[model samples]
Structures are given as C-alpha cells and as structure tokens.
Target: MSAQSPIVDLPCALIGFNDLVALLHALFIKHGTSPEVAAILAHNCASAERDGAHSHGIFRIPGYLSTLASGWVNGHAVPRVTDVASGFLRVDACNGFAQPALEAARALLVDKARSAGIALLAIHNSHHFAALWPDVEPFAEEGLVALSVVNSMTCVVPHGADRPLFGTNPIAFAAPRADGPPIVFDLATSAIAHGDVQIAARNGERLPPGMGVDSLGQPTQDPRAVLEGGALLPFGGHKGSALSMMVELLAAALTGGNFSFEFNWADHPGARTPWTGQLLIVIDPSKTAGQSFAERSQELVRQMHAAGLRRLPGDRRHRTRAKSLEAGIEIDAKALQQLRELAGE
Candidate 1:
C-alpha cells in the first residue's frame, strides 16, 4: 500500500492568487530556482489553482523543488529559439521549465503564423509541470488558433493491453470566437488523469467504473491500485490510444526529446523532473480564410446551443476563474503547510 498523505485530515484554506503566487515564488527561489524562472512558475501555478485545475496547482511544488535540488533541471537555464524553416520555430529549453520556453516562443510564433498562415514550434529539454491550455490560450486570445501537446512520464497503458507505456499525454486546442472569449479545451487521452488518481488516493476515494486496471493488468476501480502499480486506460479505447500515440510522437519524436519510457528510465526514481517535451502550433485564421474563420466557428457554436447543449469545455474554467478572482482560491491545508516549510517559514 502507498503511504497516506500528511494533509488527509488537515483543513482547507482560502487564499488569493497573489498571496499564493508570492508564497510559491519564495519557495522556488529558496530551492535555488532563478528569480525569473521562479516568477514564471509561480504565475502558472497560481493560474492553475485559480482556474480550478487542482492537479497542476501548488500541489506540484514538492516534485518541482525535488528536481531543482537534485539538479535534474536547471533553474537558471535559458530557452533558445530559432526559425528553422518558413513555418517551423524550434525552442530549446536547456533543461529548465516549459513556461518560459513557451513564453519566449509566443510572440515569434504568433508573428510567424500570421505571415505563413500557420507555424509550428518544437520544444525540448524541458520539465513541463502544468496544463497545456495556458500555452494555447494566449494565441487564441490574440485571434489565432492554437494547438499544443506534451508527453510526460508514462503512467498509462496502451489499448488492448496493460502495463505502462504512455503518459496521460494531453492535448490542448483553442480558437477565436465572434463573441465572448475564445473556445478552448485541454484533455488527457487517458480515461482518468494520473494526477486525478493521485488526488483520489489522497482523498481516500474510489475510482469510477472502467477507469483503469490494477497492477496485475486486470480492470479495477480502485484508485490505490491504479496509483501504486497499475495503469490507466485510454479514454475511448482505440481512438484515445491513437491520439496518445500522436501526442507522444509530436511532443517527443518530432521535438527530438526523450520519450515517456526514456524519461522514466533517465530519472533517479523520486523527487526528480520528468524531462518532458511539448509541441505548439499556431494558425492565423484570418490569414487562412479571411473573416469566414470566425463566422463559421461562431455558426458551429450557435448550432451547439441550438441543439440544447448549454456549455462547452472551457466554460466551467472561466466561471471558476471569475469566482477565484473575486473570492480567492482555496488550497488544501496540508499543501499550504508544506509550501510554508519549503520557504523556511
């Protein structure tokens, strides 16, 4: 059995995003991360928590700090960007975090897409520790379509078989809208996210039916089984499995980085960075088909509402973001305590 979490019975607390970011920044800096890198990490962590993405929030700090302390990731490394082709932008993260690498590539990516109709960025040598949406949301807001994918440490199994092979490999996509904010969605190809399994185990809850299999490769709904030694299944069997494969190749093979299995082997077991990879592609809709891009996408949204489907993938996140901005975000009491200790408070 896995060890129980220290905060299983601790009370939860409400904290504003600013305060949380400050705490996280302090903790990262204390652990040897450069100020600039720490700031980028802190901002992303705060945004994840504020948007109700609990899995990638401050909860990720311990793992990140572990990597920093052990030298698996270079907190002071700088990402280098080069336009390798007419529409290809390559970003080398130099073994640092993904946030800054993505940030550095953003403006150039947008400009390239606007001029070439579409642009692709291959990012490697980074430790990606958050959701993929944050990387695409900005491009969408700037009136471009954005799609991104990343490969992580394998914790999921390929379809029709068991025993780990793929990470919860996630893909994120976003596009501009005629009205309201852009439409966006980020999802793991797995039936259940690895982080969700960890959270479920921490909460002492049962996994949903058909979520995954036990260590023995038998279908099981026990979170502990999945987390301890089992593997999560693809979201839609063969289809999800295919997409997972696509993500692994796009984020790893094309980007010239370690595959999930390679990352798993390269690490020293606990408290280490995953040394993941990501690929980002941006498309300028107006450049592609003029104003019709927005018009057609709006028509599609209208059709969805006309069919009585009330909301879309990122709607809940916007709502939660609103609430977080007004009332402050909440953090698990135990996580907050641990973060304080990391900061030597």
Candidate 2:
C-alpha cells in the first residue's frame, strides 16, 4: 500500500484535506454507503491521497461505484462484533467495506489490548480495497505496536506455479517511538500492487522488468498486458510466496473469510474488490518489553541514521503528509472533476 510513483506532467490542482474528505464522503453516500460507512471510507481514502499513496487514493472511486451498482457489496451493512476471548475480538463485516468494521470495534480492541497486554481482531466477510497502513498506524500513535494483514483478489502467481492464485496480500506494521512519529511500513507480497499496475495501465506507463508476466506466461513490462489476463509475480520469489500463503491462512482461514481464489464475481461484472478478510494484532509493548519500548525504538532509529541511512520506513510519507497539510494535497485536475461529478456537484 505504501509504494507510490508520482504521475509527473499531469494537470494538477490543490485541495484541502477536509475538503477532499467531504467531497468523497458525499460521493460515497450518493453511491450507496450509509453516512457512517461513508465517513470512515472517505477519511481512509483522503488520508491515502494526502500521504501520496496515489494508487489507493481517489483512483479507486470508480471501482467502488461500480461494485455498489453491481450489488456486489452492502454499503449500509452494520458490523457485528463478537467478544470471543479475553484477548481476541471478531467482527463480521456483513459483506460491507472493512474500514467501518474496524471503526466499529476500535474502542473495544484498544480496551482489550490495554487490559490483556495484547489483543487480536479478526474481521471477516469484508471488502478491503484501501491501503493497509491506515488500519494499524493509529495504534502506534497511541503508544502501541500493531501488525495487520489482508488478502486481495487473486492476481499473483506463486513462485513455482504456472497460474495466478494468491492475492497481492499486503502486510503492515507500526510501532511507537519516543523521538517522533511511529515507525510504520506497508508492502504487498507481490512485486507490485495490483492497483499500481492499474495506475500504470491507465497512465500508459511501462513497469520495471520482472514485475509481471503476460497471459502467455512470458515476462512483460507492459502494465496493460499484465492487467489483461496476465499476472504479477512474488516480490522475492519463494519468500514472498510463503508470506502470501501465511497471509491467506491468517486473514482468510483463521477469520472465516473467503480465500482469494474462492470468491467468484462472474455474475457481478463491475465488482473490482475482493471479498475477503483481515487480521490485526495490537501489542502493549510496555507490558512485555520490560523497558521503555518507545525509547528502544528511538534508539534503533538513531543507530540507523548514524549508519548513513537517509530515510526510515515512513519518513517520506510523514514528510509528504506534513507538506500536504501545510499546502493542500495535489491531485490530477481531471480526477477531481470526475469526483465532483460523482458527488453530483
């Protein structure tokens, strides 16, 4: 979710964060989502764009509208949370989007983690099409460590397989630090995210070598070829393949959700989202570290900087977010016009 390549040379305009959120909120509610669900998704999407995660930002609005129109998702479904155990919580998203479900259970999840030293929240029957970092970064901001995983639509080929089976399946982690912002990162198991591939295709850009293969299973740099009946490869061959397999097991099987290859959307032509599951684990690092976890993390950062490491995992994003807040987010003019139309402005 964190990988972003600026689309240079586009006609751009600037919009404030709140303004973007309000516009997206109106658009989602106009489409199908309830006010509550719309608010959560709108904030999630706007945050991505604000942080320069272009692939998962406003670029996804059309797919969302199409899925809503196709009846592939329930935009108004209320999430049902279950108190499964002292340190575990489960949320049934009721076939709706994942953000609302996470919002619904956020309070209880935090309470459990504080009380039990660690907590796990499993969400199933959900559609998660946004970036993964947003789901865990807040916990880090609250002086906690969090890890999350979510499976996507099947578009990645396993290391030794001839066909695609695994989803892009991203993993995100965040940990609090004493010095500054939390240490955070989000990356797909595949060499590149499906959304990035789509962005490249839309912009008529060529991908780097070894990103994906065509329908004939031949390596190709053309994003269109990869999007059209082709598939992406694992980031580190067998290692990424194994991690993706682990993601499927944890996010899907353990959460009682559909596997990446299980859901069929043949009847729902415009359904671009994956009906899958998500898992998040939150830890009270102070309870287990026996010392100041934030201080320790800050020390690690200091050492990395002393070693000539120019930037950390979330440095660029934090810098971008700061600049965006100071001087509105930059967005493509055409995309903003389309969003206005979608919001019926």
Candidate 3:
C-alpha cells in the first residue's frame, strides 16, 4: 500500500457536491490516478453516496487508492465487452477495479434494455465492488426493474460447518416507485456484511447474536475473532445460504471466474488474489405493462406507504444524502485526517 500523509483534524463544513468531487479527484490524482479516470472514480463514489450507499461512498477511497498502489488493479485500463448480443452482454474488467466496468456495463445494458425490453450482463476479472445497490438503482430510476448479484472474497461459512466456504455474495433488486426514491433492496447474503464486521472491529464492539463463528467453528460475538479466523453466518439460515450459492453460480460460474471459496483472498502478491464477478439483469416494465407501469408502480407505492411501513429500503439513504448535500459531506473527522495524511497533505 502507498504511504498516506498525516491526519488533520477539521470540522465538517458546507461544500457543494461538485466541490467535494473535485477534492476527491485531486486526491486520487495525487495518489497516482490518471486525471480522466480519477474524475470518473470520484463521480462514481459520490453517486453512490447520493443514492445513500455510505459503505461504498468516499470511505472506499483508501482501498481503491491502495489497490492502485499495489498493482493489484489497473487504474488506467479500460474495460471491454465480449459476446455482445441483443438482450445479453458480457464484459471483461481486464484486472481492474469493478466500479468503472460496472458503470459502463450498466449504461450499456440500460440502453440495450430500452431497445430490447430486457437485457442480462455478466462481468468477470473485476475487484471487490463496494456496494451492489448503486449498480441497480439507476435502472429503477429509469422506470425499469433491475436485479444484480456479485461474488466476493470468501468470508461466509455455510450452515452446520465452518472455515469460510463462500463469499458474502451480495444481491440487490430495484423497481420504480410512484413517489420518493426507487424501491431498492440490497443486502449481503451473509448474516452481516464484511464492512459491518470491520466497523465493529474498528470500534472494538461486539457483533450481535448469530452473526459469525470463530475459527474453531463456534459462534462468537467478538468481531476481532470473526475477522481473524471466523466466518460470517448465512442470513435466514439455509435460505440465505442457498441464495449465496445461487449468486456464486450465476455471477462467477457464468462469467468463467473462480467460484466461491476458490477465489484468491490475499491482497499481496503470492497470496490469494481477488477475482470478483457480477451479473446484472434489467427489465423494462413498460414492455410488459403497456405504458401504465409507472402509474401502477406509483399506486402500489402509495398503498405501501399508507400501510404505515416507514423507511423503505433506500429511503433513509436518500434522506441522508440530501442532508449531507445540504450540510457538506459529513465525513468523519478521523476519516478525513487519515485521507489527508495518505495524500501527504
């Protein structure tokens, strides 16, 4: 990893979205990002947060910058698609980080779906993508239904066993809604996300019950133990495990990448390398509903909202984003300090 500069303590202040993006772009460039690619990455990171995906937001800068420094990912490589066909697309990331490839693929698929009414895209040779929701929500905003799956470095243990046999294997779905943000459902198939465990460990906090098992395959709340040798449990028990397997098969197997538990996990050379894969499906609702799709979706959303179901999946995120935009990025003081230090500021 490249050495970061020192940390600087600063208070949060109001900053325009574009200003924040410029700062990120400058930071990435200072860390060796090509000027053009840095802007794209900064845009993607900011867009993720705008859609309420904090986990994949600016916090990911360190990881991405480090990956670039280690030569594990190509910061300048442009992803290319192969086996392109109507309603189907396949992309090769060329050993680059997943975001740029995913963004390009998503745009291509959205256009393809608009023309063909539906499209499926598979991607391989990508690195760990921070959040799954950002990849699918755009389709929903465009009045299409979207589903996506991604396989990660193995951190999940199948039920009745231990030793980390599968990746968290996240899946996300989105559909247009009549009001507010699109209806989005994004979650790790594991009992909890890897980030959650990392966050817990950073804060020296214990995980809630049934989240993970220790190296000995015994359930434990100690986040550090879980991070060390333990594995995360599947959410919803067997059901979640089944979903994880399905995602691995669909995302990895179909894309001709390493399977779950078979992927490289090490960040350094000679260690297990990360070989992530993803699958995306987009459906144009108007094709099926004959142009009334949007109206019907709005009605359904109205009904759901009237039922007193507060806080739809992505609602809080949208709200938080609006607040953040109104009051700067609200970055953690410590995180900013660390970033500045990394940049040698």
Whole-model lDDT values for every prediction: 0.84, 0.93, 0.77
The best candidate by lDDT is 2
Per-residue lDDT over 1-345 for candidate 1, one digit per residue giving the tens place of the 0 to 100 score: 123443566678888889988998998899988889989999888899999997777767767876777777889988999889879999899988888898888888888999999999999998887878888998888889999999988777888764788888999999988876789999999998777887888777999897898889888988988877888988998999999999999999999877888864344544445687899999988866455677778888999999999998899889999999999887777777777887888
Q: Which candidate, 2 or 3, would have the higher lDDT against the true structure?
A: 2
Clashes of each: 0, 0, 7
Ranking by TM-score: 2, 1, 3
Root-mean-square deviation (CA) per prediction: 2.2, 2.8, 3.1
The TM-score, computed over Cα atoms with residue i paired to residue i, of candidate 2 is 0.96
Q: Which 10 consecutive positions of candidate 3 have the poorest summed lDDT?
A: 1-10
lDDT order of candidates, top first: 2, 1, 3
| Candidate with maximal TM-score | 2
| lDDT score, candidate 2 | 0.93
C-alpha RMSD (angstroms) for model 1: 2.2
- Residue pairs with backbone atoms closer than 3 Å in model 3 (clashes): 4-341, 4-342, 5-341, 5-342, 6-341, 178-298, 266-272
lDDT of 2 by residue, 1-345 (tens): 111333446699999999999999999999999999999999999999999998889988888898998999999999999999999999999999999999999999999999999999999999998999999999999999999999988899999999999999999999999999999999999999998898887677899998999999999999989988999999998999999999999999999999999999999988878999999999988787466999999999999999999999989999999999999999988778778988999
Tens-digit per-residue lDDT, 100-219, candidate 3? 777667777888898899899888887755778877887888889999998887789877664677898999999987656788888999999887786677567899999998889888
Runs in model 2 with CA error above 4 Å?
1-8
Q: Rate residue 64 of model 3 by lDDT.
A: 75
lDDT: which is higher, 1 or 3? 1
Model 3 bad stretches (over 4 Å) = 1-14, 48-52, 265-273
